[model samples]
Target: MSETGKDEKKTKKKGKGLLVKAIVGLGLVGSGGGAAFGMMQAGIIGGEHEKEDNEPKLVRKGEEDPYAPASKDKETEGLGEVHGEGGSEYRTSYYSFTEDFTSNLAHSDALIQVSLAASTRRDGRVLLWTKKHELAIRSAILGVLADTPEEDVYALAGKERLQKRLTVAINKVLTEREGFGGIDNVYFKSFIIQ
Candidate 1:
């Protein structure tokens, strides 16, 4: 073969080899992309399924139905009250307080009433019931009241903050005084700011 013809032949072969390699590389990339897309479509990737068997099962034990309403004999007793034999129940005395405090900023009179229900443990130790915690809760309420403006108390956000503050304060007093007794909650059963 002539030198020029030979050179031309070699160049054509090299071009064909490069084209074949590029086609193979493109095919591999396309296949990988297709597999990833297929996995996503089939929900095998980045998807979650909640199985019915994985859910919590409610089991009925004893004579009580877990799903059914409480029977008359199995009625729940209120806090500080205990059920006795023969279907009788007893409640300990509860402590509570009501006070009127004047706001320094708004110069308004605020009436706050707190109720607590307390109980004694089996060890014969006197425990502050929710009713009794009212006194200690009063101190905490006064603390927050002393800092809150009268207008703010009327606002929705302010009321929420006040409730949270009262909960914290009551819990703090219960922790400090009785060691572990907690106030069920502080409710503004009646609130009036004049």
Candidate 2:
């Protein structure tokens, strides 16, 4: 064979070898990816589909709540919370504190007394949690009330703002305790200032 022809043949063989290596490498990678995908789909490996959502779910009006706490009210025993047809898409459950909160207003000596109730659109776990952690939640709410300016308690807008703050405070306590804060609003059952 001529020298140039020999060199050309060697170069061709090397190129073919390189092409084969690249094809095999790609095939291996592709097969690995396919196997991983199959394992995930079969629940043998990754949990992309099996990842359980531990968070509380919203309860639709009139729908059953698997996690709902049993009614403590003797009058409503075995009769679950009733929902009306024509309002919010989700049901609202209220938790009224057994005692009223009394605290001094911020920057003033005036005292404020308020009976509070909290509402949640989530399942009854929230209500159960609130009842379980009432002391912590009550402490948080009292802190919020004590921090509120004296002027805020008198005006409608200020009262609304206070409601929001109280709601956030309650939810914060719940979240810290239960990993989820589900309180949607805080309602004032009674308000008094002295």
Candidate 3:
């Protein structure tokens, strides 16, 4: 190895290293520009997308429901003035309990099962509240049914009274959980004694 040969080899190695660094630097600049372009397209940074309609359409105060049926104010449609004081025009809605209630009667070993449904002449919010608090409501209904006498399951009048009791129990639950109780009545879809 001569001195000139060693110097020439070192110079060539330095040139190769500088070329690789320059290529890497150019690659880094290109990728950075691409990232910036993407950010602008996605409206994350300032660009021509400045006036993009990305704001949310939140429900403001006093805004009416978009899907509700249009009708006259203060007057319920399809429900005009009644002739007598006995009857009033009102639409009734029913919500059936998802599961049948089965429990042992208080005084006897007999088991009673009742599939119940609640009626409401109010708005659909009552139904939504019923569904939301169903677990609590079912617990209350089962509590009443468990204490029911075995004899009450037989007589028509006794059953009627039981229905009234059940209605009161459910209304109590609704009133406790929600501010209002809109339940009109609770009827037994299927009542069984065993």
Top-down TM-score ranking? 2, 3, 1
RMSD of each candidate relative to the true structure:
13.9, 5.4, 13.2
Shift of residue 125 alpha carbon in model 3, Å? 1.1
Give candidate 2's whole-model lDDT.
0.86
The lDDT values for all models are: 0.50, 0.86, 0.72
Q: Give residue 59's lDDT in candidate 3 (0 to 100).
A: 26
Q: List the candidates' TM-scores in order.
A: 0.38, 0.74, 0.55
* Candidates ranked by lDDT: 2, 3, 1
For candidate 1, write residues 1-194 as lDDT tens digits. 99999999999999999999999988998998789778877767755533333211222222222222233231222222232344212222222343443344335565443333333222112222333455665666677767776777779988777767666776687667666543434456556654
Local accuracy of candidate 3 as per-residue lDDT tens digits, 1-194:
99999999999998999999999988998898899989998888877766643222222323432322245343222211112333435555567777899999888999998888887666555655676788888888888888888888899998988888888887787788776777778888898899
Taking the tens digit of each residue's C-alpha lDDT, what string does model 2 give over 1-194?
99999999999999999999999988998999899889989888876677668888999987889887655674222223547678899998877788899999999999999998888888888888888888899899989999999999999999999999999999899899999999888889899999
- Regarding TM-score, does 1 or 3 come out ahead? 3
Q: List the residue pairs that clash in candidate 2.
A: none
Global lDDT of model 1? 0.50
By the TM-score metric, which is better: model 1 or model 2? 2
Return the TM-score for candidate 2, rounded to 2 decimals: 0.74
Best by TM-score: 2
Using alpha carbons, what is the TM-score of model 1? Answer: 0.38
Model 1: per-residue Cα lDDT at residue 32: 84
